[model samples]
Target: MRVTQHLWFEKDMQAALHCYISLIPGSSLDWQTAVMADNPSGPAGSVQMAGFTLGDQRYMAIEAGPLDSFNHSFSIIVECDSQAEIDRLWTALGEGGSYEQCGWLRDRWGLSWQITPKRLGELMSHPDPAVAKRVTEAMLKMAKLDIAALEKAAKL
Candidate 1:
């Protein structure tokens, strides 16, 4: 079975889709369609829906009006293999957006994202509880994750 994430946007669906597609590698916009009938968001011919893929994950976004909006309750996590990758995504995604502690950030579109390093899991799951705790504490103190600092906290 295939699962696709559906996102609701009040407007600027195309711009948001383009931004996501541009940030992710091996991503593309599949299609977009306008509403054929009058809808709550707008008149006929307004953007109704758009399909896009980020990496291998499929997502559909609808311009369903202000009836719904994004909140911190849900977020997409991007796992990075290296510090460079994490930095790139963090800098790009945090543009015109606010940064929160523990590598969390809100994009310009108000979508929440976590730019995390793969090593974070490894450090946080160390066999020694002390090491794991240290790493966790270190992570909690930072807005953007620092891989080197995390590794140091893990004493690795």
Candidate 2:
């Protein structure tokens, strides 16, 4: 059995796919095709099917509708190299969208993303669990995650 992310877009599947691929490193769009079928609402061929990669994960995007709702329970987390990288990603993903604290943003397409720095994990995984918890608490209070601050918290 294989698992892949299936994303539903209200109208901009291609735009969302491209935007994600652009922000993510080493990512690419693999295929796009229209599937023809006979059904209600619109038609089977009404859907635009796309295959893309985000980091190492595979995802499929469909622009078929009967517009639906999206919520916070699902999100894509990107691990970055530095604060600069996090900022870059946050700005790109947050354009035309609102920002929330702790390195989270909702993209224009209403997709939630966590633009996290790679070192944050190492800092939070320090030898002392209390330090790690401190780092976690520090992270929870910030909008954009700062690697330096996280490291400082771990050392405390």
Candidate 3:
């Protein structure tokens, strides 16, 4: 069985798909289709559905009109191996978007994402409770997570 995450957009399904696919490595747009008949959402030939992949996970999107919208309750978490990786994704994804505390940000499309460094987990889960607490405190004060700052906090 294959499980896929589906997203509904008011319009610009193609642009959104392309933008998303370009942001991640090993991602691609698999297929897209336009409705042949007039639908409630739009005229015929409008974007009906599109399929894409982000790092091996398949996703589908539909131009279902503005009946629904994305919320912060759901977010895609990208785990980065290093600070550089996190910085790249954070800057790119946060373009025309708002940054939130603790590595959270809302993309231009209103999709939430957590561009975090893998070392964050290690620091947050240190053996000593004081170390973990320091790391957590440091993280709480930042929009984009800084691994070096977190490490320094842990050492204090």
Candidate 4:
């Protein structure tokens, strides 16, 4: 059995997918094609579908005109091994997008993403409740997550 995360975009599906695959280390566009048969979503050739992979995950997306808007209900999370990686992706994905508190942001395409350091999870899972609480507080105050600052908070 196979399950893929399917996305519906009103526009810019290919551009968004290409940009997204470039950001991830082991990602690619598996296939893309335009529909020729008439369907409710479009007059026929207007619909476009593509399958892709981000790391080991499979995803399919369609450009079938506006059926609905992307919202907070769905988000993609990228956990980085270093602050530099987090910073890089944060800048790339957050460009021309809306920034939200605690490592959350919406890209120009209106897709939400979480760019966070892997260390954040380790610190949050610390045995001491104070450590976790401190980390949480620090994260809440920032639009982008900082590993150094979070570690310092956990130490306090």
Candidate 5:
């Protein structure tokens, strides 16, 4: 079965979806506009939901009002092939946004993302569980996951 992530935003579902589609690769906007129940005063069609993709994962954006807020507890993790890839995503995602320590950044839309190197998993899931635990511990303290730091911890 195919799964889709649903994002709830105040009233910028269309704008946010477009922004995401522009920043991410292989992303496109889909679906027609619908009026949200919360905004009865707005124009006839301001767009309530839009389908888009950040990577391979498809996501749906909806105007769910301003009740809920975004936090670091839940974040989208992007695995990159090289340091250049990490830099590209980090720079693009951090545009008009806040930068946290390590590789975590809050995008302009207030979405938190972890731009990490793909090798991170390899290092963390190494042959030795004890070493992996150490690497995991090191990763927990940083905002961005550092491959070198994780490897150092794993080797230790």
Candidate 6:
């Protein structure tokens, strides 16, 4: 048995999947198809469905009439290897969207994402509690995560 993250979009499943796959390496659109039967969600061809892999994470998405939009409770967190990676994803996802503290942002499609650096996790999990606390404090102050600042906060 396997589990996959699922998403629901009003009418932008294809566009959102393409945009998301473009930002992440090793991601791909596994398959997509429209509903051919007269389903409750919509008539034939009105609902679109897709299955994809975003860096080994399987996701299933459907573009049907809106039931519930994406909220911060469910977010995609990209643990970036470098500041450049974080910045690139931040820009791509933050455009025409809203920014939140501690590396959280809502993309144009109303999907929340966390563009965070891998270093942040290392710092957050530091053996020394003070170091981890400092890193967390610094991270809480920023909209976009900065690897340098976080490292400095770790004092390592």
Using Cα atoms with residue i matched to residue i, what is each candidate's TM-score against the true structure? Answer: 0.94, 0.91, 0.90, 0.97, 0.76, 0.97
- Model 6 lDDT vs. the true structure? 0.92
Give candidate 3's whole-model lDDT: 0.86
Candidate 2 root-mean-square deviation in Å: 1.6
Give Cα-based local distance difference scores for all models. Answer: 0.90, 0.87, 0.86, 0.92, 0.77, 0.92
Stretches off by above 4 angstroms in model 3 are: none
Can you write out model 6's per-residue Cα lDDT over 22-133, one digit (the tens) per residue? 9999999999999999888989989999999998799999999879988989999999998889989999999888999999999999999999888888889999999999
lDDT of 1: 0.90
Q: Return whichever of 4 and 6 wins on TM-score.
A: 4
Candidate 4 runs further than 4 Å off = none
* RMSD, every candidate, angstroms: 1.3, 1.6, 1.6, 0.8, 3.0, 1.1
Q: Per-residue alpha-carbon lDDT of model 3 for 1-156, expressed as tens digits? A: 999988888877777778778878899999888878888877898748988998878998898778878887778888888898888889988889889999999887788899888898898888999999999999999999998898899888
- Per-residue alpha-carbon lDDT of model 4 for 65-110, expressed as tens digits? 8898899899999999998988888999888988898999999999
* Clash pairs, model 5 backbone: 102-144, 103-144
TM-score pick, better of 1 and 5: 1
Q: For residues 65-131, write the lDDT of model 1, one tens digit per residue.
A: 7875798888889988889989999998999989999999998888999999999999999899999
RMSD of 6: 1.1
Model 2: which ten-residue window has the lowest total lDDT?
38-47
Error of 1 at 85 (Å): 1.2
The prediction achieving the highest lDDT against the true structure is 4
Shift in Å, residue 9, candidate 1: 1.2
3 against 4, candidate with superior TM-score:
4
- Candidate closest to the true structure, highest TM-score: 4
Sequence-dependent TM-score of model 2: 0.91
